[model samples]
Target: MAEPTTSSRRPGPGAGSPAVTTPALERTRRRFLRRQRARRWLAWRVVLATVVGLAGVVGACWLLFFSQFLSVAGVEVRGTSHLSPEEVVAVAGIPTGEPLARIDLDRVESRVGSLAAVRSVAVSRAWPDEILVEVEERVAIAVVELGGRLRGMDADGVVFRDFAQPPRALPRITTDTVTRREALTEGARVIAALPGSISRSVDHVEVRTVDQISLVLGDGRRVEWGSAEQSGIKARVLPALLQREARTYDVSVPGQPTTK
Candidate 1:
């Protein structure tokens, strides 16, 4: 009875651990080694790429900042009619042989804009070696005599270039020396409101004060236009009123025009 009890159990598939072959273990080891080598290779590639990229950035910075290859060689002026290129270049003061990127474009524009004729100026780098200055010159819409010389006046009433001889077509404006500057602006405002039909007949404007302004016609006729106020209404009424033969036309009061 004791001998039979010892041998009653039988081994099943789950009774013991499964056997592993040497070939399978070797294959796993090879796979692990291959995975480790691949990870190391990827890491090296990333480091090498980062270093190369940094070196490229540093080289480009050196070329842009320190090398003479991108330095300014000269200044080119454009959009100038009354001002010479040399004049603009001199005023710009862009240092030659300096790095193009280092040139202060805003400073150059400021200096060039100081010229009386320059309305606006733009400065930029002409890549590789030059500075470009673009200027917009003021165009005169009227003329004023100062210091016995006829000076051009723009729509803004800024007295700019001096004419060698008077421009026959341009309307002349006379102002008192004590308040010449202010008077010129008022006169310009008055002229700006007049229609082409009326403006063509105007020979000159006389300003005694800011509000006291008159227009004299080519045929010795006169228009009593007081100040620049209500000029648009006055301009509209003047052409039709001029049809009446009169020595003087008064449109100072647009609603109640008068003639003599």
Candidate 2:
């Protein structure tokens, strides 16, 4: 070596001398680089795992719910009167073999209640394989002319059905006095309260105001019932009174009977 020169550049934060390498320091730096690379690899692996797990979860859920695995096995009905079971089911349009998860309850109810006989309908899931349908039927009490058609009425004057001809057993309620609805309402309630035997005997009923109410019997006799309220009681007592009189009896006072 020539003359030994003093170093111009002082050691930085890590470098100490040029000739002697610090093996412990170099090992520490090398270890740090290795750890940094390992951290990057671990982060990449986590991202890849998250992406794959999301894909698998989506695939599994799609296979379970969307697949039509379960179906409507049976349909049960209650509260049906005039409407047949087959007709009610046909209106429901509930698809067989369709998944129960997708069962449209509102759609089914709206369909079946379209029949005139069905006043309201309710649907419930019976679990696993069946659906239950409960319906409220429209009671047929009498038929009255509505808009030139014979419309059916219940005990509450609700006109549900319009047919060309009235049913055989149901009474024909008629009036020429402009066919007032208030009279029909009062008549329906009064008719519903009468005894079954007496109510059934009425062939024709008229709602021609308080003074001119009339009833034609099946026995070729006429009753002079003055009003709808008293007529209900008259119906209950008319048979006994008729036996005594043999002619028309005004049982409007209910307990008192006068022959006509």
Candidate 3:
């Protein structure tokens, strides 16, 4: 007589659990899915940005170096008086249509400075397409006759240009072909030191040797300058000495000047 056995079996794991989802669990799952999608989008964005940056860099390099946008167009010369602009440009030899950034400015300056008339030169890029060459020409302080031709001599004793006719304003120095270069230099120094007040009265300078220099006035008076030494003192003393009536004035020893 046993009571009807009620067989009871244990439920398997999750077999009988309700098919239910809580709000928090559902929200967590959505967040995880959104995180995965966010990671994928971030990766794509990073790749796109990297590609764009590389393209910009490559484009800039091409424009600066390889392109013809910055090539030289022409050369302009300035501060040139005795030398024509064409002469300076010819000697500069700067190639046209070449890359302006690649031109050697130092070389250009050296070439232009080689001209005897150019005392100094500066070369620079005028940007966009031009090259500028500035030349400083030598200024003649005196004139000399060499080989039957009148030549201009700068203050430094450099004989640069030949004059077709003698300049009436510049004081002429008498030096033959056989005259020593030292004598020419000394004579030039002496002439440069004279003040305009005294120099204007001089007709010509006589250069016998390096130490022997004399200034002959228009009225036939002779000034024994002796040498270039103490020239400043001599220059100052001579102005006062000239006020006296004398055929010859000696300022060789400025402290003990003599007039006869």
Candidate whose lDDT is highest: 3
- At residue 227, candidate 1 shows an lDDT of 84
Which portions of model 1 show Cα errors greater than 4 Å? Answer: 1-31
CA lDDT scores, all candidates in order? 0.88, 0.77, 0.90
List model 2 lDDT by residue over 188-251, tens digit each. 7666766777767888877776455667777767777766676656777877776774557676
lDDT of 3 by residue, 1-260 (tens): 88888769866568776667899999999999999999999999999999999999898677655678988899999998889999999999998888887889999988988899989999999988899998889998889998888999988888899999878789999966678998999999999999998888889999988888999998999999998999999999998899999999999889999999
In model 2, what is the error at residue 207, expressed in angstroms? Answer: 1.9
Model 1 Cα lDDT, one tens digit per residue, 1-260:
56655667766668495765799899999999999999999999999999999999999898888899999999889999988999888888888999998888888889999999999999998998998888999988778888899999887778889999778778888877776677778888898787888888889988887788999999999999988999989999999999999999999889999999
TM-score of each: 0.83, 0.56, 0.78
**Candidate 1 weakest ten by summed lDDT:** 1-10
Q: How does model 1 fare in lDDT?
A: 0.88
Following a full C-alpha superposition, what root-mean-square deviation does model 3 have from the true structure?
Answer: 4.5
How many pairs of residues in model 2 come into backbone collision?
A: 0
Ranking of predictions according to lDDT: 3, 1, 2
